[model samples]
Target: MSTTPLEAGIIPLVDAAPLIIAREIGFAEEEGLDLRLHRAPSWSSLRDMLALGQIDAAHMLSAMPVAMALGLGGFAERIDVLSVLSVNGNVIGCSLDLAARMRAAGYGFDFVDATAAGRALIAAAGDTPRIGVPFPFSMHAELLYHWLGALGVQAPQALRVVTVPPPLMAQAMAAGEIDAFCVGAPWGSTAVEDGVGELLLPTTAIRAFAPEKVLAVRHTWAEAEPDLTRRLMRAVWRAGRWLDQEDNCLTASEILARPDYLNVSSEVVERSLTGRLVISPRGDLRSVPNYLVFFRGAAAYPWRSQAALMAHSLAARSGLDRAAAVKAARSIFRTDLYRQNLRDLGAEMPGATDKVEGAMRDPTAVASEAGHLILEPDAFFDGFIFDPTGDE
Candidate 1:
């Protein structure tokens, strides 16, 4: 049988592992997909490639499809998030000088206490700090806003936001173009390794199990080639499950460290996979077990509640119609597609598409088609929970 050829655009990041692993370990081939991976220089380029039909799917920021669906970035297209690719892989860090200032100001570099850390950063940077994020429409940007706003730091007034691709984040910081950044591994590890920045906290510190990236497919293509889309999701889903295994961390790290992948050392990539992050040039290590999740606790499921929360965040900034955007965002997540594709695969399909985001305080068993789905803790550090009804 002839294999269906599909191409995906991705930036070099550790969370892109599932897509790479799908191709590397024959998961794609097993599902009759001839998957070709293309490397984009930046998120904007990757977004354009996906929007322009240059690729069949993309390893995209979790918020990208919703942002596009809501017509935020000037270029609007119907996109579907087939499933979440990775969760909670991002870290916030500052230049070594800023790190020193923050440390000198009596703030210990403990990975917990995100509020205290933000307050310390505010105190350390008296002037507005120029912070870089991968894209304006990214979880990095949203979380930065969420974290800073929680501490009463008015954005663009207390801190300036700029765009720096993941690969160039460390260089930008080193060159003083950006004072700090919120980016995913191994780029955070790269910044620390290069002696330029110190990792302060994982984004999970702000919102544990925060949706990060998605296995995104253009909606038109998915509708036209349903079988191909389902096959691709199943293939990548299997790869994500394989990646979450503790035993596969080392090998997964080595594979992602190849030049065509993250192009960093296996040791750097391994830090994220193992959740043992080297936070500073001084080799300060912090263990963040929920730092990066692939398949655990229904991480891959495209929860509509998450989409609603992101839509709310974006709505606040853009002054978009909150209700309409939330509805559109929820629709774009394509939870139905995820369920349709993976239900028969013995996956523990969630009983409900929407939930109270950031409400779970511990491992709680939820209703599932498979009868057993224990969800991980997903509380915001500030103890705020999102009402899916837009009640706040």
Candidate 2:
């Protein structure tokens, strides 16, 4: 079915930085399609917009696509999750009050030893700690959940879970509404610089190169627009490669901080993008690369292991079926789309499928099974509320 070129509209956000940069920077144009970028109010707002066909696709949360597939979200008439937008760009932050007390009680940048670090942080909190997350079905919430659980503290018992918008996280912390927050770029970096909070931990240390977000579209829409989907993925893939360029980091940072995008200061965006995070007043901003990965570095290969880990996470949290959970998750996390994107750009695929660990101590391995990349799911979780109708 042929349609008007550039007829599709895409919604944007901080996580959508790459897609925005891809368009503003020409990767979208190279695909020979006209693109429209729209800003959404929130995740559910964007999901509803995409599901209603108000937009062709979206810069979405990694779990958003799968959540829709499993009817874990609104108007859950299944949708096809096409590709990853970026990876491992999130950070765990704590307020100055909490940070000081933790330091006074002996908790520092101990990324590898997540278990002990979480216990100490929680212990530093005199009573129930109020932590903010961007959304209910976000990597922020899941990562925080797993990391805190490492200390034998479940999200419900150990602390209070608060839903603060990404943009408002820093302000909420500064106001003492939240003691800590798990969030993606700019905001986390913004908090630390504004003297409201401290970025005590990088998510990479918690979940090495974890899948952070993706491009999602209605499954029926994807089936009908196969060529468009391929073209779209290729365009974003090229954009990813461009963003990964060291020199382009500054330029990309400028694009993300525009009022139409993250709506924060460019200085704040650069802090996260250029690997310079402001820890405190007296010291320098620590280097954290690929903070806001877009193109290939973050968006390039859709690791099967990343998909499996999301399943393990959702299963562990919600008690969904692990095997069935794996199937449903794999249905949306499309590596096939990723391959097309990489091929058009003439980029060689990653030499080998590597094992990635999520927030859990367990490792997720990737292997070829039945011509598909198979990632190992967690065995410990057997209880989750899964609707079988969505299972493929």
Candidate 3:
């Protein structure tokens, strides 16, 4: 009886729940991956470890692989992102004053209207608003840029974008070090709960399928250990499915709140998980359900629309050509690996065929009534897997 150790890095956010749960619930062990879960304090810390193969893999941001693939920032290598850990788990939170300014400015504070508020924040802050995001290359920063630019408000050189850990987001908001923050769950909801800030937008408000965290591996490692990568992806997919069960939200929240994981209260975690979001009980915000989702059937699969968006985002940010950026995006966002793992696992699957599109159709439309099982549409997008190296 030999234990095969697979070292993996994780960050302290709910989006990392899939990796943590896969380890804690025996899925990784069953797969013969003796998982050694190490906590990386920040995204850069996690990225460096994965880039250098210090850890075999990491729970990462959806944009990270794209940015790294395009050499957007200081990340030197072309790393590959094998799978998305979770999608649409982020939110935009602002100080009470910032929230008020938004209302006074006549912009609805949901994702669809975030462009207005994001630009308004930049305009109101003028020289600098001292905004906080987890990491520069993470989805938070990319999304901030998209939302701001959508309103014709470029992130001027004067606007400050700082890195703050998810746990510290609440304290920073209370201390007034940051004017607004775009962060993963618990922290954003925690701020409003404590009267330190107000919830501005549920991330789903803008794009329902925004990619949050991903399973990132060194490009070389993925090429060398295809079996290990498949095993890892299967474990993640299983863990994701396990978390999606309606009855499992409470249990999953407990797992995530342990000191070794997210280290947040179960109450704070639940709000994000079940959409019991308390959007300012006494204020103008409204509470909503279906907030945080580990698995929403086909919603969990790594769709290519998200990959293209990441490509476009990295290109826009780094001033790269759009075609080259899309090519970079396809390399890492591989659905073939995902499909192989699904077949090996004998898991019930969505019937997503080779078609690639910006959005996936409702799985319920094609699912057989016997199992109530949802299937991703066959040819869901137009020839989705044509080239893992795109811009075609």
Q: Estimate each model's TM-score.
A: 0.97, 0.83, 0.83
Give the residue spans of candidate 2 off by over 4 A: 1-14, 109-113, 155-159, 281-283, 295-299, 350-392
Better of 1 and 2 by lDDT: 1
| Candidate 3 similarity to native, TM-score | 0.83
lDDT of 2 at 39: 75
Model 1, CA-based lDDT = 0.89
Q: How many Å off is the CA of 350 in candidate 3?
A: 6.4
Judged by TM-score, which candidate is best?
Answer: 1
In model 2, where is the ten-residue run with the lowest total lDDT? 377-386
lDDT of 2 at 84: 73
Report the candidate with higher lDDT, 1 versus 3.
Answer: 1
**Candidate 2 residue pairs in backbone clash:** 6-34, 240-295, 240-296, 277-285, 319-383, 319-384, 319-385, 320-384
User: What tens-digit string does per-residue lDDT give for candidate 1 at 1-392?
Assistant: 57889998888889999999999988999999999999998787888899899998999999888899889784678889999999998999999898889988899888898999998998888768788998988899988988888888887467688998777888899899988899888888888888999998899889888899999988899999999999999999999999989998988998999998888789888988988998888888889978999998999999999999999889878888888889899988988998889988888899999888889878889999888999999988888889897564
Error of 2 at 186 (Å): 0.5
Q: List where candidate 1 sits over 4 angstroms from the true fold.
A: none
Question: With candidate 1 superimposed using the best TM-score fit, by how many Å does residue 367's alpha carbon deviate from the native?
Answer: 1.1
